[model samples]
Target chain A: MTGSEGPGHQVQAIGNDEDVVRVRQLVRTAAVAAKLSLVDQTKVVTAASELARNTLVYGGGGEAAVSTVDNGVRRGVRVVFSDSGPGIADIDLALTDGYTSGGGLGLGLSGARRLVDEFELDTVVGAGTTVAVVKWAR
Target chain B: MERVPILKIGSVLLVSIQVDMQDQMALQLQEDLGQRIVDTGCRGVIIDITGLDIVDSFVGRTLSTIASISRVLDAETIVVGMRPAVAITLVELGLSLDGIRTALNVERGLELLARNAEPDTFDDLDLLGDPETTSP
Candidate 1:
């Protein structure tokens, strides 16, 4: 029952610093439009910020899609980050906190996972990674 | 290449980051702040982040790095004007910003620095470059 889409779709390129801020703003706007609370907005926006950075730094740049979803019972905001770059060799290890190949906090994947109600990850080593996250209304 | 203004106030340096910020911009601030520490011979630093709506991991790490660099430069870094939502978000993001001092606002931050400045022997200002060197 996830056919209902709210507002519309937004696509932003994540290749540099400016894009990262843009993606965060985009995600926050969609979350607000979905009527998410201030705290929820901050959480989703923070997740989007992390994922977008990963897409740029780790994934070697990509694109993000922002959309609102209505699952018949709950309204939610979703952002899917796709990038074609050297993918994660071990998803588990990559998700582990403090494990970073780029000297980051390594909280991008796991922390983002915890911030949302639904998370989907797809990656193939030497190929790319796609992360989709959604925060539903409370 | 936007430069975050690092104000030289008496014995303390005040910096207020008001932009949404780019990675390079944050790096630039880090570099400029380090240079300012050496050039101004300040003993303390206070970074105000009230204008920032979000402090992602990148910004969080930058702040931590700034604090670390300042400590090594014979100066202290105190971050102020952190919103409650941003704080929660940082925590949920698994970043504690360890070892960074903070205050409610600029006034409190200045007060903290002022109190610490008394009997402050900033004699070893040369430690601004050498992290291995420590002096009170």
Candidate 2:
């Protein structure tokens, strides 16, 4: 739950490089608050960086939310990135490593998925794309 | 936009990244380093990232690019001071940082560069084993 007690209260805009860094800091704070291990914290922060960049470059600027989640037994840090740019036409191709439309390493989507516990992607060809990822503490 | 400073010591250039580098900042460092390598004619580069919290794909790619650029300029690049947690995360993230050499710290990095730069002093010894070798 996103409350004033934690750092994941605001939905920050991902308009430029600065915003990406801000998103990373927010995710790290939330991850630490969720009591994740140091390695897990690094993984989530790295994943957040990749996704935030994708939201800015491929998605043409968007927003991200960092929050802590609970599913009865486990507590996790969740990050949601949403963009209203040209949505991905081929999800599978985009998810493939080394495949990029913007001349990137093509690790943004695929690699981010590997670093987290749960990954979800929703996109529309002409509308937008939203990616939600969760990294749970063990 | 903050710039990462490049310090020159002897023939090696030391770059200690103390900030959380943005995408543009990373690109700026790559360009600045390329220019510094040419300006100083440095033979080796040691990049310290102990202050970096994460080495995401973007940063990893930038480091790789920097290594290539330095190599083209006849310089060696070694990435040092990587945190253990970051290394674990990078591996799970599937980025091996190809073409980039890494060390545990700056001292070892310098040692690596020194070893690589060492000249072969035993070139004449190879002739001893040749078929043209004659008894003294």
Candidate 3:
């Protein structure tokens, strides 16, 4: 689903590093059109980029969606990153600082969560992982 | 996607780039810089990132790696030119690049690098001579 052609106000892209970049760009563009301040726009875009990367690197690929929220009083973007890779073994440890599974410094998941106003993670060890992040204009 | 050179001033090496550094490119650049630090026998390295408008977690982590590797190699590492917005986003994202050094510009980074360098080598190098010093 494209951002422009939706009742859900959604935009979805395959999980890949490049696709993550695209998603950030889309979020930035939409945030701008929604009249978000430059500061708020960058926050949402950067957060989206981090989550998208996690979806690609850990999830073994997934999809990302962006849309407006809160009746336009504030614009919110939600990204649902799903991956089929080995799921996070320790949720708490993974969220801790300096904890890293891959070569990363373990910032993607935790950092993305911090940047957004709402954050949720649902994962099953062998099944897959899904992360949802939403940020509202302040 | 251009390969930039690592600048050397005395015992310090400086590398600066203006691009949307992300994913593998960021990692590759960090690795290459680490190798250069070892090869050059520099005492410190400074990465001037003034022109970067955005930094993803991958790039942030790669930079942290560069700093860590620099220390292991006995070279100091500094990240400069971090825009306020970028810094705020990074902090809010909970991405802590702790243990990494930072400066405001190449000149300040060079000075800091020089300060961290072997004192004897400080007098012999000129950082502003030419950007060509960084050419691969």
lDDT of 3 by residue, A84-132 (tens): 7788889998887667777676777777777777788898999888877
Q: How many clashes does the backbone of model 3 have?
A: 3
Evaluate model 1 with DockQ and give the value. 0.62
TM-score of each: 0.91, 0.91, 0.77
Rank by DockQ, highest first: 2, 1, 3
**RMSD of model 1 against the true structure:** 5.4
Q: By summed lDDT, which 10 consecutive residues of candidate 1 chain B come out lowest?
A: B121-130
- Fnat (0 to 1) per candidate: 0.68, 0.89, 0.62
Which prediction has the highest DockQ against the true structure?
Answer: 2
Candidate 3 backbone collisions, by pair: A59-A83, A111-B93, B5-B134
What lDDT does candidate 2 reach at residue A5? Answer: 32
Candidate 2 DockQ, CA atoms: 0.81
lDDT of 2 by residue, A8-81 (tens): 55688999999999999999988888889999999999999999999999999999988887766667898999
Best by lDDT: 2
Instruction: State which candidate, 2 or 3, has the greater TM-score.
Output: 2
**Candidates' C-alpha lDDT:** 0.89, 0.91, 0.73
DockQ of each: 0.62, 0.81, 0.48
For model 1, state the Cα shift of residue A21 in Å: 1.3
Report the TM-score for the A-chain of model 2: 0.93
